[model samples]
Target: MSAVGANTSPAIGQVHVLADSEKELPVPKRQRLGIAVVSELDSLKASSATKRDRKRQSRKQKQLEKLPEPCSSDDVLWKDIVSVLGGEAIDAAIEDGKDVQAPLVLQEEVELEVKILGSNGDGIAVPVDSKQPWAVVVPLTLPGERVRARIYRHARLHSFGDLVEVVEPSSSLRDMSRVQCKYFGSCGGCQYQMLSYESQLEFKREVVVKAYQNYCTAILEENMPEILATAPSPLQYGYRTKLTPHFDGPSKSVRKGSRKPTTEQPDWLQIGFNRIGTRKVLDIEECPIATSVINAQIAPMRESIIQNSHTYNKGVSLLLRDSLDTSVDESVDRLSDAFNKHICVTEPKSTVREKIGEWVFEYNAGSFFQNNNSVLPPLTDYVRNAIFPPSSTAPSTLTHLVDTYCGAGLFAIVLSPHFEKVAGIELSQDSIRYATHNAKLNHISEDKISFRAGNAGEIFAVVQDFPRDNTAVLIDPPRKGCDEFFIKQLLEFGPKTVVYVSCNVHTQARDVARIVEEGRYRLESVKGFDLFPQTAHVESVAVLRRVD
Candidate 1:
């Protein structure tokens, strides 16, 4: 059936509210109480550009040009905020045959064929008939899948919905099997478990390439390196070494910000993970993505929580870390058995051992380490080999290596053998402490590898000591990626080689664009690692060399 001709209705930009009884899925109380203010959009005007738009653009550019150079993007944190500013939605009791004027009215069900997947892994379907500008985004539906969905939200650009069911599955679903975990759809932990392992790798690669082409196409026009083939994961499932399951007490009628404790008992302890898009928690039994040892602790952990659920009047987050593998070595296994038991029983305060390749790393259980231990060796080796290319006929001219945002010193410690001296800088003292211990654990000399708790604002302050022409800087920033200040500082420091690692490719592409735009660095190569299998997340590493 053609989706366009079925029950044709007038375009509406208003928000719609559904009664609690009409909601198919149990929405969190917070979402049910949300006030949506949608803007009225003229479909024809929106589709076609106007002369006033050019004038407005010219005015905006003039204003921006007047702004001071080196403006404080450091203080500015980029975020996308959508707000609804008008009236309540259509009545909850609207007749079934009656035409609704609300575009994203709750309980408004539609059958859509998904055309593509959005960055957050949602299936986007633009209506073939609608003169309206917005598309319907349905979660848990793949590209080319015909799905039934109920609209719940109206953002500026698109409408969001929850998938009711797949009416007709995509061809890709032929390769996909049933999701292993029972809580796969509800839990936000994994997004692509339904997709086959090989397909997941390809999807991740497409995500990286699309992000760059969409956000940083101008930079690519200058010098776009072919994004290399995605490195496959050694283990698809049972790869994660850590899991943080949390619990929050049942909702209360107490006044907000009141310090007084409520005498009324909670209905039940809501534990496990936050529901896919809501603050509501779904009690979890097992996570297939986590290591077998970590999954084994779920029963005992739940038992403990049940026993103390009454005491937990507030929210609590429990950390489970399978830091050590017993199958690594005989002697080390015996020594780490006590440590592993201690980690499982109590909160890890001291260092925990994690076996990666030949080295046993000592890092705090809570510290930042590679999430997927199975793919960490290959990821690290790729970075190490990229630093010194075999194709280069000249010997290594790089004397010093500086690693910024060196959490637990993974890159610094592993790549120490390639450089004369490596200086690792971190903002967190706790991470630096573990990093130092990890270096010692790996038998790296103190003189050769040094960890420092340095200021992020002054990240390149230490690079002054090393010759810019002979130094290489490695940065593996958090998911938000580096700000303009850091990128500006990096450009000023002007190292010989820069290896940028990031989990979020959009931000990585943005930062890399600035580096190449400055005409100092040329993009050498880009490679993605499937560190997070069964999910949309991909770890990407980009290599850039100083233009001679």
Candidate 2:
């Protein structure tokens, strides 16, 4: 043999012993390895790649776990949703779609008669005049309408379809005359813009009804009161105080090196909500659902974003909040005219002000406050009146109110006058700070109202001494609703009454079902508030009384 070992092929997993390369010595070679491959012979440096991949995969898994989950999934549709839409009809339709005789190919077009509008505002349809096992969920359709739909996705129980044509229109439910937004079907921001406002409210009531039916135990439903009519917003089109317009960088599919983008493509920043059933954003010139001030600012905001597109690396939501600049005129008379002075605040950390009747609230624009300022007065009034109904307040022993998740003390401050003592607990230090400030701003004293910071478990522990028989708990949790640990703790505390306010009725129903289980509490009533009019979103309030 030559003076040195001379095998030429070297791969990531293969060990190589080498001498310095020279034409006379040996040829040096490196062979590519399969992706994510592992071998005992893999070099230390080569193993680093596998380690990186594992770590990156773990990070992605954690991120996915943190994402919000919808009420329905591919495996099973919610029973109440199925019942409300088309129970046996849907089942039959699904079977027909999967039938060997009439196979549902991808992008297959079929005329379907929509049976009912789903809680999400999509139309549920079955084959026209066919006793078949197949159903197609189509958007921009109404009940009793014959619509031409193209099957795009076939799920386990049902299929999803794109609305191609309305073969026969619904005279009652389909009211396109009232549509405010051009992006009604395309944008995910709204679902009921085409329907009458009254119809939207009615649909919301149906949502609550179905939510309870699907999410709650029969015992809870038996105790549940007639779900009150969904309260409507005063300004349906221009009520939203906050609008987050999102924009993304250019699509990766565009060939960057091939052509000048200015000549071939649209501007890079595609700003708006996600297109319905898609992750892509649509460019929007005006959002009619947002407040007047935000709409007026949209032109300038879009221009600024376009001008600084180079600064953004990925998609981001730009907050455009409608807030009153009370500082411009601090006079008592000016407070009443605050709405006329609405200004659009773009910065998230910037403080914003809104007045609900006589009470004023100031919080960071980034904070989670009610989006519709018009609905707060009636909503708060309903809650305050709900805690101790007029007939029960005088003889009631409930003198203490515990406001959980009390961001900026919205409910606590609003109900403080009715209670002898009130305490607000929040997880965010910033929210707690705002709550304390808001109490002072609203002229509530420390002895009457207080704010605490920590998790729900910690807050309940600190308030353990409060008499369960004399206190009422008001919980306004995030859309995901309360966790099991928190619910268990809440049951242990056993307050006299519990009022739950949630933006997500589905999750609220699930949580309240647990609270009212085992005959421990009676669900007094459930009501819905149209906090987001012209959209499918509804805020639900469920009142519970101890019965154990």
| lDDT (0 to 1) per candidate | 0.71, 0.78
Candidate 2 lDDT, 9-117, residue by residue in tens: 4454677665455547644444335322223234445578889999996775464324235444321243523564467655564455432223466788989888877
TM-score of each model, in listed order: 0.76, 0.81
Off by over 4 Å in 1: 1-104, 174-178, 253-267, 325-350
In model 2, the Cα lDDT at residue 85 comes to 42
Which run of 10 residues does model 2 get worst, by summed lDDT?
1-10
Q: How do the residues 1-548 of candidate 1 rate in per-residue lDDT, one tens digit apiece? A: 11221222224553556657768865434311212111113334554467678888667546432432221221110111111111111122123311123355677888777777665666777544554434677778788888888888654334678888788888755344657888888888888888887777888787778667645655677678788878999988888878888887545643232333334323466668988768888888889988888888988888877765545557888888875543344245434555344234237574567767777676776667787878888888888788888788999898899999998888888888888889999988988888898888778899899988787688878657888889999989987789889998998899999999988787788788878886878888888889878777788999999999
Clash counts for the predictions, in order? 4, 9
The 10 consecutive residues of candidate 1 with the worst lDDT sum are: 74-83
Cα RMSD of predicted structure 2: 8.9
